[model samples]
Target: MTVSGKTRHRFRCRYTSMPSPTSSLSSSYRNPGGSVSSSSLYHHASYLRRGKLVLGIMDFKWTLVFVITLLNLQPSSANGNGTVERKVHVGFIVDTQSWMGKIVDSCISMALSDLYLRNNHYRTKLVVHTRDFHGDPFLVLSQALSLLQSVELDALIVAESSGGVKILAGLGSRVKIPIISLFAAAPSLSFSQHPYWIRIGEDESSQAKGIATIVEEFRWRSVIFIYEDNDSAREFLPDLITSFEETDTRIALHIALLTSSTDGDIIDQLKKLMDLHTSVYVVHTSPILASRLFLNAKWLGMIGKEYAWITTSMITNFVNSMDPSVIEAMQGVVRFKPYVPSSKAVRRFEIRWSKNIDGNQNLQEIELNVCMVYGPMI
Candidate 1:
């Protein structure tokens, strides 16, 4: 009726060493009167007791009866009965060291947890494995390969803001694994080129219309455009130019700032723009570069009520995460951001996320697109 410590250890070893269910049941010994088997006793002894044992049924026959009753009480993976649960392994590759990457990782983790916790009938457990690329392209590829080969992930979720996503998407296609992107938004990485690639971020081209609308509403006939020299910005610039032309808004000057641009280089560009008579400007670049440009502009006294500064969604998406000084400099700047609906689920998620990254003072807001895209996919 009671299993000793040694007996319990022996039972565990035997149970673990046993072959598949398809094998013969000769290893199992059945009790007298066809009441219960040794296997059933082992199952009950393993789970029924807590820290201390209190067996009301001291007789072996009664113990066998209780074991049968408890075994039947176990939950089944299937809707009916006698089914095994399936497990899915998913990989996340992102720059966890960065602020935005940390936010994305947190959102993905919360999404996976919410999904499995709410859906009991799913019968599929999602195991998430994460790797930090540290914002390096080569590291991203290497880590991705390791996930594919070693981890054997069913799918991959990548959050990146660089040009390396094309290579990453290609690798996902080559391995026939779905690559869900929460950050990359270049139109060139469309579904046709890489069928395995799925983007949740808004396409850069789509924001061109919004920018044009803002320009037309303000009656700005001509405006200077400043953008980073990256694939997304370059691809977006042409579309924005076309949209401006359609709306009869001429782009008086277009400035492309390299990521490695020095302060002098930025100042030189700013000086040129300052000399121009056009007071309206449209800036499309990363949050870092945008902050730097605005800080320089503030020092030059260009960011004022007289100068109307309009930015695309790229800068607006990370406005809250920018430095206080940078935000102050661009106080009068106007931007159009994607709207996120208010819900109890979102509010709870926001509170949880805020606590997760509480130590990170740099990240003040969550990127809406990242949260939006993950909502439906998970």
Candidate 2:
């Protein structure tokens, strides 16, 4: 399922071969039009027997030249600042299972295809992987490393949810290439040991600090933290609670331990918190769990005036497919502000990107920002 090595490895695997169109034409040229040309038919039979279409050195060289030329036509580059030109064959290791991964992958693809690469300048390829960690971060890290090893790349783009980040941080030293984390929340990955790793999304520490600011602004005396008791919550909840200590906030931790996170479990948790006089109720959970909370809250008629719920930015995808009334009702009540994009610049790029991709504007702002920034630089 995965391609390995610079050269194609021959195996005892079933495969088919086809003759070159040029050779087929050449043999036909030597004979008059008939039921079949003898030379052409012989070459075709030979190709089928070989079970592989092997291109000559000249074709390989031409392909390399074309790819190089395509990679060179970027809108921005290190050379723009009069710096020495250092080209890169960037590889993106994306998780196709997650919503954010798909967004980042599409953006990278659109940026490469529509940017200078299409014009024959900068060379880039996106290597899509899957997030099948099942709450284990190590699985994600291993998959990324394995896929990365298969590609010839100068940089790697890793897009993962929480569990994925843990795996990547653990495997930080082993991954020699520059790895940029896209839409990740793990803060530990930003440590000095992994200098090549850059956080493309808001780090957990930054997000926790941001929430602390909100808590202070509202002058909430007592805070209640409810998390979907999973590995991510286990890893982050303590750090998040501790982050509030810097602001002199007292946090009452509430755990809704769910094996499968059913609607009943969510409502049951809300019932317990309903009587608590906490002003801010911080939800340390996924958007799937967030949607459950919102739905249960709405059904119980406690969404509007009772308690204000705050969660992570993961709810953006869930918000899109939510009930319109639920979405509107949860706006101020359940808020998670993302990094604000400058409207003017974003609009301009949206128009241009839409035109290039040949469709309507349908990309996340962060992903679009990556495209805008790197499109010119690649």
Candidate 3:
């Protein structure tokens, strides 16, 4: 009852070396059957008056426990117990630094947001983990492997023309999950061969027919054909040839340029076509390369009233957003793309998409296969 500061210090030192301190805190200082309040962060002074001595310990330090709870105590991956929605993990690998990849990424995000907004009561959600390759096909393969190793993916999505479609599809087959391919124009994929691989778009056969039909309508006997020189492009040539043969239009000249062709390289190619008797030119390649070809053609005065320039859907989809000067360079150039109906939803998507990509002018409406973006979540 008369303990001084020195006496309190001695008692404190004696209690400091105990094997278990809970015993003294519960039994020696508290009420007869009362134990320490382990959950409460602080104890009231009234607890001491009633001889309860409610000692508050740091019971909130359960990071490991919370993690275990999230892993073991949560609901299944598909169904929730009326508390939280279950997650269906998805993996997306793309060249995000590229213009096309960035647009695809935006479309994927819009699809996911629209999906959950319409189905807020849905029990499952798709959680996407994205890896960017920045145009390197090898990086795409590595990223696919990394995602497969790190996540229990419900599905994995890749750009079909990204050059690793076969390897990624093989990975999906081994894991027994679906591999969704977007913008599939490479002509190498066969649905029958790879059961796990799902292609959202077709190769260039339909587009080729559309181009040939234009040639027939104009009564052009033959026209020059230009395409990117790559394995995929080479494989695509037979389709164009067959389509042109049907319309009795001959491919007078076929020129191939590397994907990395420069302004000088493109202008040189155009000059050759300009000197030719046939004035019609059908150019098919990736968007970037197509831009260079047409712009160079404009510079060489090959895109004027005398010459006819046509392009595939790949370039048309993003043509409206190209620098106005580039679009002007493409003046009188004809292109065929999947017709997208103008809806309020589509208009809003275009506006928001332009803002996201920081477009200087409005982008022309085009088709992105919604089925591919939405299927992974299901």
TM-score of each: 0.73, 0.62, 0.71
Ranked candidates (TM-score, high to low): 1, 3, 2
The order of the candidates by lDDT, greatest first, is 1, 3, 2
Error in Å for residue 240 of model 2: 2.9
Q: Write the per-residue lDDT of candidate 1 for residues 253-341, one digit (tens) a residue.
A: 88999989988999999998878878788888888899899999989988654576767767776777777788778765656554444
Mark the regions of model 2 whose C-alpha exceeds 4 Å error after superposition.
1-88, 117-139, 170-172, 231-235, 256-259, 316-318, 329-331, 352-378
Expressed as tens digits, the lDDT of each residue in 1-378 for candidate 3 is 000121101000011112242232221222223332312101221121221111111122242243234334334543335565666677888777765676677778876777778878766566889988778777878898899889877777786475577677777778887777665535555656667776554435655655665556456788888889866667667878987888778999889999888899888888777778887777778877887777777777675546667776566666655666776677556655544345686677766665555642332333342322322222
List runs of model 3 lying over 4 Å from the truth: 1-84, 354-378
lDDT of 3 at 129: 93
Model 2 C-alpha lDDT per residue in residues 1-378, reported as the tens digit of each score = 011112221111100112344332211211112323323433333333222212111133443464456445433335555654435555555555544544555566665555555555323333333334333455666666666677545555565555665556545557665565555445454457666555544334444555555555445666777776666566667667766887767786566556487877777877877777664677666656676676777687665433456665445434554556655546444334333335796676667655554542333222343323322222
Model 1 compared with the native: what TM-score?
0.73
Quick one: best TM-score, which candidate? 1
Per-prediction backbone clash count: 0, 14, 0
lDDT of 1 at 312: 70
